[model samples]
Structures are given as C-alpha cells and as structure tokens.
Target: MTEPKNLEVCGSVMDGIAEKGSALESPSKKQPTEYTVYPVRWVVLFIFVLYSASNSLQWIQYSIIQDAVVKYYGVSSIVVYWTSMVYMITYIPLIFPASWLLDKAGLRVTTIIGAFGTCAGSWLKVFSVPQDMFWLGFTGQTVVAIAQVFILNVPPRLAAVWFGADQVSSACSVGVFGNQLGVAVGFFLPPMLVRAQGTIEEIGADFQLMFYIVAAFTSVLFVLILLFFKAAPPTPPSAAADLGSNLDSNFLQSIKKLLTNRNYVLLLISYGLNVGVFYAISTLLNQLVLTYYPGANEDAGRIGLVIVVAGMTGSVVCGLILDKTHRFKETTLAVYAASVVGMIIFTFTLDCGIIAVVYLSSILLGFFMTGYLPVGFEFASEVTYPEPEGTTSGILNAVVQIFGIVLTLTYEWMLSNISDRWSNLTLCAILALGTVITACIRSDLRRQAAQNKG
Candidate 1:
C-alpha cells in the first residue's frame, strides 16, 4: 500500500464514518474516474450560514446588555459577566461532545439544535425579574453557546469534505464571511430596534424584549435550514447513500493525534490566547471605558455597536485576503500584533481623549480580533489532514473556548477590583504573548508542509 502521508486520511476512517450516517461519503468520491471538483452547494451553504447567524446575537449582544443589565437590574458586574461568560464556560466543556454529536448526527441536526438553544436563551431574556433575568440570560447564553459550537465546527468541516483542495480555502473564506455578516446584522439590529422605541428601558420592557427580537429572527433562519440542508453525498463509487457510523472512533483518535501535533498544539495555545484577549476585551469593554473616562455610560451601547461593526468588517476583509493568499500564519500573526498595538495605545491614552482613543483603538482591535478565529480555523483544518473535517475543527474550536473560560474569569476579576486601564493593559500583554507564541510555531508549520510534500 502507498505510504500514508497523513495517517488520519486512511480509507478505514471513512468506513467507520460510513456506519455513522452523518459522516456520509463525498458524492465526488462516488465518481472518482469522473472526479472533477464540484461547485459548492450555495443554497445549503446559505441555509447553514443563516443558521450560523444566531451566534452573532449571542456574542455581540453582550455589549448591548452589559450596561442595560447593570443599570436596570442592579446586578453586579460579576453577575453581568456571567451572562456572557456562561456561554463560553458551558461551550468550552461541551465542544468535544458537541463535535461528537455533529459527526454522529450531522450538521443539519446539529445546527437546528444550536439555533433552538440560542433562540431559547433569547426568549428567556424577556422576564422582568432582574435576578431571574440573570439566570435566564445565563441559560439563554448557554444554549446559544451550544448553537455556536455546532455552527463553528460544522461549516469548515463540510467545506473540506465537499470542496476540492484548490477550493477549500475559498470555501473556508465564505464560511467566515457568513459568520461576519451575522455579527454585522446582530450589532446593527439592536440600535435600530432601540431607535424604533424611545428610551433604552422602555424598549420592550427590558433586555428580554431584545431577546425576543433575536429569537424570532433565529427561528426564521431555522426554517430556512429545514427548507434546504443536505448532507454531502455518501462514500464509495457506487454505494447507496450510507449514513456514517454512529460510533466515531475517529473523533477521539483525531483529537489525540491533533493534541500530539506540535504545530497544532501551538496554534491552539496562540489561538486560545488571541481569542481570550478578544473576549476579555469584549466582556469588560463598557466598564473599561467607564473606569478610565467616567460618565460615558449612556454612550456605551453606541460604542459597543461600533466595535462589533468594525470587527465584522475586518473579519470579512481578512477572510477574502486569506482566501486569495493562503498566507494563513503570517496574516494571523500580523493581526495579533495589530491588536497588541491597538490595546497599548488605547489603554495608555484613554484619559487624554476618551472618544478618540476608544474609537481608534476599538476599530484596530476589532479588525485584528475578528480575523483570529477564521485564521485558526483554516490552519486547524489544513493541519488535521484526513480527519473527519468537522471533528478537527470542533476540537480546535473547543480548545479556543477553553481559553475563553480562563480569560472570562480574569475579566470578571479585573472589573470587580482593578482599574480599566490595568485590565486593558493586561489584555494587551496577553495579545503580545500570543504574538510570541505564534512566532515560535511559524517555522515548524512551514517545515511540516515541506515534509508533507516530500
């Protein structure tokens, strides 16, 4: 037999997946002699993209609710932190399991479940009781976290299985684009809703109202999934559409292999740290400005929207650049460095001019921050070789969520006790650390590619 360059790519993994219907073989594999790369399934892609949209509401809405919850509910910063942190906390632990579920159940099933979780969480936000609202928000975020976990893992995984090697980068790019679009819509939607109804407090009787709005939109997206979502065609040249195996030895085995991969392990650390910094900044963002500038509470909502919108724009542009160049590592490192620069400037100069410092730093930070995810996803997908596409992506996604947990905890502590500048400074330091880690692993990644080619 030909030497298996990538052990994960063996024909056997496909067999194991065959037993699991969700791991259906590629339709192209059915016609190897006629194998030409098929065009991407744009319709199903759109539906999945829509399904993925709910996550943006889960993540970005934190900024919107941060001030609202703090003011109206009399909730402490710590509790408010939990509202957002709970999602990452629940999500990090369950990512491996969620990945397993997706492989066993497939993207369509996984995405719908995820969407419902997000929608449920949003609906729960409608209650008037502040304390109850906190828990409800937590529960809601947790559900959305699960939804995000699936959406994050599945799209790139599907792209790998469905698209040709030449097109994989582009497919990955499109998925990231969808993710950004969701974020943009999520951020923009809140302000519009607020405008339609005067006074932030009266806007639908609290945060729950906003949740309802988001939930309704997500339900619509879920229906879109039902209208058009298909698993990739099954394996073997001429076998009936076999669902992949219910038992996924590949999931665990793939995780083990990935954990052992030095480059991948480093990427996980760097990616996690980078992600941690972003979330850390996002979760405490309103408080950060309030601490340094003071009396900026009213404008916090507007500022939050600006950061998210800028981040969304950055993510899309970065995705396009990555798609064209395939210079994944360099692009990621540059973004990390840019974040560090932005954070440093913003943290030190905040007192000088609040609006100018905040706006400039946020735009820079948002630009770099949003791109980290897709870069990490692309790198993980490329490194995972022949593992079930989504499985590796899920593992990588899960690892980053772990960092998110640590960062979120740190954020809670900082907001409770430290000055905003200190917190921002700490985040800056973390991003700087990530940049160093990325530097260490850069050469190794290049070496691995050369070895693989050889």
Candidate 2:
C-alpha cells in the first residue's frame, strides 16, 4: 500500500481536471483503481460561485451606502447597521440546520433552497425600497440573510466533493473567491449608484433600482442552476471523498467530534476574531472613514473595494502556496501576523487623513485579513478530517457571525461613547490575541497525515 500521487498526466489545467482518471485513485486500499474525476465538477463549481456571490452581494449592499440608507429610510445608523448585521444574526441560528442539510441531503438539494431563497429575497427588497417600506425591506433582508446559511458553509464541502486532493485548497479558494468578489462589487457599486444627497424619493428610487438589478442577476443564476448542477461526480474525486462521508456517524456526532478537537477550536477562535473584525470594519466602514475625513462617502466605498480586491489576490496566492507546500500552520501564521500588522498601521494611518496612505494600509489589511478566510476553512477541514466539511465549516462560520455581531456592536458603542482611536486599538488588541492563539495551534496536519499513510 502507498499514498496517492498523480502519475497520470493531462495537457492543460482544464484537461487535467476533466480527466484526472488514475489520479483519483489513492495507491492504497482506500481508493479503487476504476475511480474517475469528472469535467462537470467545474460547471457545478461555476454555478455555486455565482450563487454564493449573489447572496454575499446582498450582505454588504446596504452597508457600503450606510448614510444613504439612513437618510432614505428616516432611521438611525444603527437601524441601517441591522440591515447588514441581520445576516450575521440570522446566520448563527440557521447554520446548524443548513449544514445538516448539506451533510445529509447533499449538494443539489442544499443549493436549490439557497438559489430560490436568494431570488425571492432580492425581489422582496425591490418592493421594499420605498420610505414606507422599511419594514418590508427588513423582512426581505432577513430572508436573504437566511439564505446565506445554506450557502456559506458549502465551499469546503463542495471542494471535497468535486476536486482532487491536489486541488482541495485551490478549489476552496475559488469557492471563496466568488464570495469576496461579490463583496468587492458590493462595496464599489452602491456608493456610485445610491447617494445620501438628493430628494428622499430620488434616493429611494436608486435603492429600488439596485435591488432590482440584484434580483434579475440572481434570477438568471437560479435558472442556470436548474439547467446545470450535480450532486457529486459520478465517481469520488479522492480517497477522502470515496470513504470520508460514509464515516460521518451523523450531524450531531460530527459536531461533537469537532468540539473535541483542540486545534480546530483554536482555529475557530482565531478565525472568528479575524473575520469578525473585518465584518465590524465592513459594516460601519463609512463611519470609520468619516471619523477622520467627513464627506468622503465614495472614498469609503472605494476603500472597502480595494480591501476586498486585495484580499481576493491574497487568497489565491495563499491557496496556491498551500497546494504546493501543504504548510498549513506556517502559511496561516505568516498571513495572520501580516494582517495584525496591517490593522495596526491602518488604525494609526486612518486619522492621518491622507487617502493614499490609508488606501495603502487598507490593501495590506484586506490582503491578509480577507485572504485568511480560505486558510481557516481549509485548515479546519484538514484538522477535522472526515468530520464532514459542511458541519466543520458551519460551526466555524457560526462563531464568526457571533463574533461579528459582538464586535460590531462593541465597536459601534465605543465609537459613540469613547474615542475612535481607543475603539480601533481595542480591536487591534483582540486580533493580536487571535494571532497568539494561532501560534499555539499544533500542526498535526491529520488529514495530510492520513493521506500520507501507506
């Protein structure tokens, strides 16, 4: 018996993915010689990317244009905050059941709900964009938030189902790319489209138009999903896919095992803190930027865009590194430390009132911070191998949402009651603690170890 290696070769990356025949088989008893990798996996992944991107676009759409939402709805900024934070709040409760559906019901079934739910929520918001429709808008937003629970944790599971061992981290990164790209677009587009200046009706009309655009986009993707999607490849992509899921006793049991994992628990804490701070900063980004330079609403949106765009590049780089090196702990720690440094620089430079320096700092901050997202996902799934990726990622994400809610509220409170400097400093301290926690996590690399076993 031996571990798997890609002895078979194909021409291009696409060809390799399309016909990774013998590479699908581990040189051990775990994988059968006859197993094959399918081309349709890319099609499935493509649709999933669009589905998740659309859902995530909604999460930040109202946030980037916070002041506009406040003025348009005749509500408080905190009220506008809920428009974004509701996704986090709603995600915590619903992720468990959604992950269960992913683990039990499989891919096609899970996405069916996510796609339609997103479409329905988008259309609902289109109707709710009037000043008198804030209530309807909130309900519709909550519906979109609920749909996220079905989509958020599917990335890692999707990778495990559709990709080869050599491709897991990279595949997961693409899955994550869809999400961050949507956020990037969300941050960039809203401020350009909607404005706080203008008559209430004019502003409301812009908001309505944006919602309709998202609804139409999601509707098209929904139909495409129905046209083309698959539960899994005809054959498992790797030995893990061939055998791992069969070992999942049940969702409850998977959750129990995940909780017992010391490394994964540390990852949960670190990942939550890292992502939570990003969420906090993202949700009230306008306020943070406005603190130093007032009337820079468009600049704030651009800053958010740059951050996510930088993070997208960082995630791809990180994923490729992981694929080649398989150095999860080293890669994660380096990126995490860089992110902490970036945050510190941004905290001080923010008040400097120099847009260029702030943009530079934001790039550094977003590059590592957002890039850290897929690192945490792949690492968690790696350590908790065979626990079911959906369940592992779901619990991790739930913690992220919990922390997002807490940190956003806390940051908002401190921004209001205390001073901006102190508020920013506090979050920097928490992120440093998270980095320390990451340092303490042992690199058992259990999943890789299992793969290496012969």
Candidate 3:
C-alpha cells in the first residue's frame, strides 16, 4: 500500500481519499476522483422539500376556507386575510437576518431553526381551535410566517450544494414545486375538510381537524429533519459547489456584490412582480371567483387546484429545459410572455361565468406565473455565482414579499371600490411589465462570459 499525497487543484483540496483502493474510490479505477451521484443527497433534498411543503400548507390554510374561518371565528374578512398576508409581511424584515444565519451557521442549523419555529407555530394553532380565539390563530400565523423566511430561502442554496451543475435548475425546480404543491394541497384540503356552506359548529369542528392534521404533519417533519438532515455532502457535488465551498465572504460583502449585478437587479424587479401577482391571486382566488361568479363559490378550491397543478407541471418542464439548454434568459422571456397572454385571457374571461374559459385561463395563468419562480431563482444564482445562494435568493424573496404586500393591498382596495375585472386587469398589466423587464435582462451565460473575460 502507498501513502497517497495531497494536492490542491483549482483551489479544491484533493486528498488521499482520491487514491485507488481507498474507501472513497470510484467504481471505475481510471477516474477515481470523478464525482458520482450521492443517494443521500436526494434523501436530504426530499426531506427539505417536504419541509417546504409543510410550511406552505399553513400559509393558505385559512384562505381556502376563508368564509368559514371568518364566520367560525367571528372575524372580519381583513382579519382572516391577514393570516396569509402575515407571511409576506414577516418575511420582509426577517429574510436578511435569515440569510445571514444561513451564511454564518450553514444549512443544518438554519433549517432546524426553521423546523422548530414551524412546529411551535403549528402547535400554537392547535390550541387556537376554540371558537372566539381568532387572536390565538393570528398569533400562530405570525410565528409560522417568520419561520417561512427560513424555509423558503434555502432551496436555491440546497440545489447549489447538493446537485451537480447539470442538475441545478431541475433540482431547484423540484424544491420549489414542493412549496407550490403544498399550496395546492392547502387550497384543496381546506374546502374538503370544511364545507363552504357548513353551519358554524360543523365549520369549527372541521377547522379543528384541519389544524390537527397540519400540526401532526409538521411535528413529524421536524423530527425527521432533526434526526437525518446533514449539513452537506462530505465531498463537493460539482464545480459550483467546489467553488462555493471556498468562498468565505461576509454577509455584507455578499449583499454588496449581489447589488452590483445588473442582471440580478433586473431579475429582482421582474421576478418580484411575477411572484407578487401569484401571491395576490392565491390569497384572493376565492373572493375573486365568488364575487364574479356567485354560482362558482363552491368551485373555488377546484379552480385553485387546477391552476397550481398546471403551474407545477410547468415548473418541472421548464426546469428540465433549462437544465438541458442552460438558456435562462430565453426561458424566462418565454414564460413571461406566456404569463402575459394567460393573464390577459384570465382578465377577460374570469367574470364571464363561463366555467371552461375560466378554468383554461386559470391553468395557463398558473402555469406561467408559478413556473417562472424556480427559473428566476436558478437564474439569479447563476448570474451571482460565488455569492452565497441564500443571500441572492433571500433578497429576491424579500423583494417578492414587499411586492406581494403592496399588490395584495392594492387588489383588496380595487375589489372593494372598483371591480374584480379591474383587479385582474391590474395583474395583467404587472405581468406585461414583468415580460418587458425580463426581455431586457442580459443572459446569465453572457454575464458569466463577461465576468470571465474581465
């Protein structure tokens, strides 16, 4: 047996583990140092995605059964709406701090904190099941909203760390899809559990069951994350990961560097608009449908499910395309264009009372709107390479939160004073603007080339 020597290549430490017959040796002796897929990486990502889903399950739980919650708790519509809006509001102030924590302490610590916060919030909501305890529910929502800042900001970082460059976009898409799927579940589950036209007592009992279901799920995920989630793989997964492992820039410096990226700034604006509109629509879907098509109030959950399911499909497809082509700019522009078209159709058709048109428009709108999320997240990471993924993603999400709050309030005002049609028009206009902004963004490939040349 030989004592293998260590070498540093391209700033990465290659040790004796790369030698032949070593425990870490590749199956092919000829390429002992080549990276191979780590099965545990997928397991960790799966758990995190489930955590992401659980976090979102709580966010829109009340929104799906908005009327029942309002009547059951005797709270006004605005108070119930705040349950979801609070998630956006809390993320604005806390995202930067969460990013800092992720950068300073690494993924394990950051995610456990998120899981614990979510678990505590879920348990709190369980206690709030008593009628007339709307304030307790609100308090629990506030805590969970804060926890979302931790969970939502980590997908891009997770993809970057756990996946090879070839799989980064797809990996991110899957992670994001988990969150979207959770929203879909939230939309569908609440209505099934709590009937729209149920009596106050029945509604209260169903709501309690919903809380218990969500609480039990959250508790299980928290325990799983605590027991099995590792910080990262022992070996770097890809060149990006290898590079990321060596970068030790402070949080302030990371933010400063990201701000200087013009492409990222453009993405921030466009992605923020896209996400803002999605949040607004998600939060108000029931109200929008019921206000216009009184006969369709019962179908609100089905409509929501259709939109999100379409969006989930789009996310996965778009991710695969980006992974294969690495065409961030083109894919983004196309999605934005599709979103504009879909939003225009939705604006025109939603109030027409034509079920088929409404469903079609909703599917298209959801597909393009929600599909753009993972693309934008991955694109931001690509352009801002070597910067902490959490920092770039955190800023992007914080921007989305700010936009979400503004847009949600604006939509609410419009619905009250104007008409649902005008609110839909407002969203369409924003999507069109997002398309224009996306068109102007320099491709990540071009930016990388420029950086390399410089």
Candidate 4:
C-alpha cells in the first residue's frame, strides 16, 4: 500500500513525478511488449563456427599424418611436431594486441580480419605441397596461428553480445564445440586423405590435394563472414550488455583491471593449466598412442576421433547445466576431479594391451578434459563482468599457450629420456593440482545472485 522502495529512493520531486506517471499509466499503454528474438544471430554463429573450424583444421593437419609428413619433408619427428607448436607459440606474443583490437574495433572488424588471415594461410599451405617445401608449410602455419589469435578470443564475447542471459553459457559451448569439432575432423580426415605408407612423390601429391581442399573451404567461409556477420544485435540481448565499463577503458587500463580481479586471476592460473595440458596432449597424441600400443599406430586417428566426439558432447551438456543452475564453481571442480580420475585410468591402461580398455579410457579422458573448456570460459566472463570478454579470454588463452609450450617441450623430453608411464604420471600430478585450484575458486555469480535477491 505504501510507495515502492525504488520510487521512494527518487532524489528529486521531478524524478518522483515522472516515476509516478509511468507507474500509473493506462493499463493498455503500460502493457509489456513481447521481446522479439532475432534469428539472424544463429546465422552469424554458424559462420563463426566455420571460421573457428578452419583455424583449428590447420593446427593438427601435419600431426595426424605425422609419419608421412616426416618422410615427405625429410625432417625429424621434433621438426614435424613444431609445425603444430608454432600455433601456440604465435599466440603468446599476439593475444594482447589482438584483444585490444577486439575491444576497440568490435567483433565484426576483428573477425573479418581473422577470416582473411585464415583464408590466406590455407592457400599459402598449397605452395608447400611440394616435397622440398617443408619450410613453406611452417610459414603458412605461422600465419594461420596468428589468425587463431583473433578468432579464439572472440567466443565469450560473441555469446555475451548475441545471447540472452539465460543462454550465454550454452551459446559459448557451441562456439567452443566448433573448434573441438574441427580438431576432431582434422584427426579423422587427414589419415584417410594421406596414405599410411607412401613414397615421397605419392605423399607430396596427396598433401597437395588436401591443401587445395581445405583452402577452398576456408575461402568460402571467408566470403560468408564478410557478407553476413554483424558485430552485435541491433538491441542489447542481455542485461550484461549494459555493464561493460571496461569496453571504453584503454588497453593498459583494461589489462590492469583484469589482473587485479582475484577471481579472474585464480581462474587464469587454473584454466591455463587445464587447457595447456590438453594442447600438449593433443599435439603429442600420435606419439603417445603409438608408443603404448604399437599395433594401433594406424588407429591413432580413431583414438583421436573418439576422444574429440566424447569431449564435444560433454561440452554441450555441461554448458546446458551451467545455464540452468549457474553453478560455475561446482561444475568446474567436478569436471576437473573427474578428468584426473580419467587420466589416471588411461595412464594405467595404456600399455595393458587391451585395446578396448584404451579406447574407453580415451573417451572418458576426452569427455572430461574437453567439457571443462566452456565452463571455464564462461566462469571467467562472469567474474570479470564489464571487463571486455575478449581481454579476459585472450589472457586465459595466452597463459594456456605458455603452459602448452612448456608442457609439450617437457613431455617430449620425458618421452625420449624416461618411460611413457612416468611421463603420463607426471601429467596426472599436474591435473590434480589444477583440480585443487579449481576447488578453491569463489564464484562471483553466487555473490551477484545474493545481491539481486536482497
């Protein structure tokens, strides 16, 4: 019966009068309008999926066809591995500037440039199709890796801009799923495209065809993005859209704010460890599988396919759960714990010579490992709200790259100098450490929810 709290707080008589007029307006005039949902946003997301897939396709291209690549190029296994490592290496130095571009220029301009880089890199690989052009392939990979710096950091930003609050995490899962799907396809397709065993000339010819096929696909996606992708919706789709104080902050100010956020910093460390380990394992998956089960060397692609499929499915499911419950901290910790168990089981079964056990363990490992990605990205955005999503995600990815480089190099050394079992056990230890860190995180979302209720 008394004045509503919000109306009582009005500071001026004029403001109170305006509030009363609005509150007492005719019922017909005051009727709430139905919020119109745009379908064009999905079209834009599909284009982004293609762009994300193209960026990742090039990353594992050589790794999937490792033996043939080493033979055709006459390089050592170490050199062959660097073709993939270059992607992580390039990201570390470039992510900050890339984040600045995303925040300053907006998503459309950033993604268009990223698409062009992807197309250019794909075509550049075609020139390296000759048996003598290994260096050229590496050069092309460098360019593509740079393109990845732009595209990979945009998913959280994309979700924040296009999706409603209830749907942000699910939307982000789809974007992350696209990259993982690309890696899955990369693993499955290359083995079939390039023969298991081949003469240098034959291998070169097969690789030439493969490059052309990928480049053509990337070119089509680039055209699509240029023509249709919009930076954001015509109207804001979520309350968070109005909360971006950091968007107008200069590059240094944005960086400083993110670094000072306790929740964001903790997530950066924990998330970096999880993803860095994934990158290292993904790059070295062929070597690990072949070492443990020599007979299954030809089946590496199948192993990768199973792992990725399980991970991609888990990502979507986890995303849905987060959206429904907003239990960011609990969800992340559970997956990290499950992943450690999965990896421990996988490590023990690796050389047991039971092929079925190995495959099951691989799928479990993939499901838990890959599923955590979207949750981590979304959690970081929540804690760092109003800070540009691009900056936060970019920093997380850059840290992951740094960890990936170190872990990859360390694993490579361990495989050469120690037993495969010991190397994997060390990784299990790292995963356990990540889980501990994840458990300690205090969810900023929980605090915000409490405030809203009050």
Clashes of each: 16, 0, 0, 0
lDDT of 4 by residue, 392-438 (tens): 88999998889998999998899889988999899999999999888
lDDT of 1 at 104: 71
Error of 3 at 440 (Å): 1.4
The best candidate by TM-score is 2
Order the candidates by lDDT, highest first: 2, 3, 4, 1
lDDT of 3 by residue, 314-415 (tens): 999998998677677788899989998988888898767687788888898889888888888877876776677788889999999999999998998898
TM-score for predicted model 2 compared with the true structure: 0.93
Model 4: how far is 3 from its true place, Å?
34
> Model 1, range 1-454, lDDT digits (tens) per residue?
1111121111101111222443444534442222223333566666766667667656756554455555555667577667666667666777888888876776667767776776676666655335445566666666676667777777665554444333444555567667666665644555445432246457445455666777788778767766667665343211111212222356678778878988778888888888777677666666766666565654554555566667666666666676556566777778778878877876776667658666776677667777566667766655555455567677666777678878878776776787666767787888888889987774333312421232
Q: Give candidate 1's TM-score.
A: 0.80
Q: After superposing candidate 2 on the true structure, give the runs of residues whose Cα lies further than 4 Å from its correct spot.
A: 1-35
- Tens digits of per-residue lDDT, candidate 2, 229-330, equal 877765566555555544534778888989999999999999999999999999989998987878898999999999999999999999899888888889
Give the lowest summed-lDDT range of ten residues in model 4: 10-19
Output the better candidate (3/4) by lDDT.
Answer: 3
Taking all chains together, each candidate's TM-score versus the true structure is 0.80, 0.93, 0.90, 0.90
The candidate that wins on lDDT is 2
Tell me how far the alpha carbon of residue 127 in candidate 4 is from the true structure, in angstroms, after superposition: 1.3
CA shift at 447, candidate 4, in angstroms? 9.2
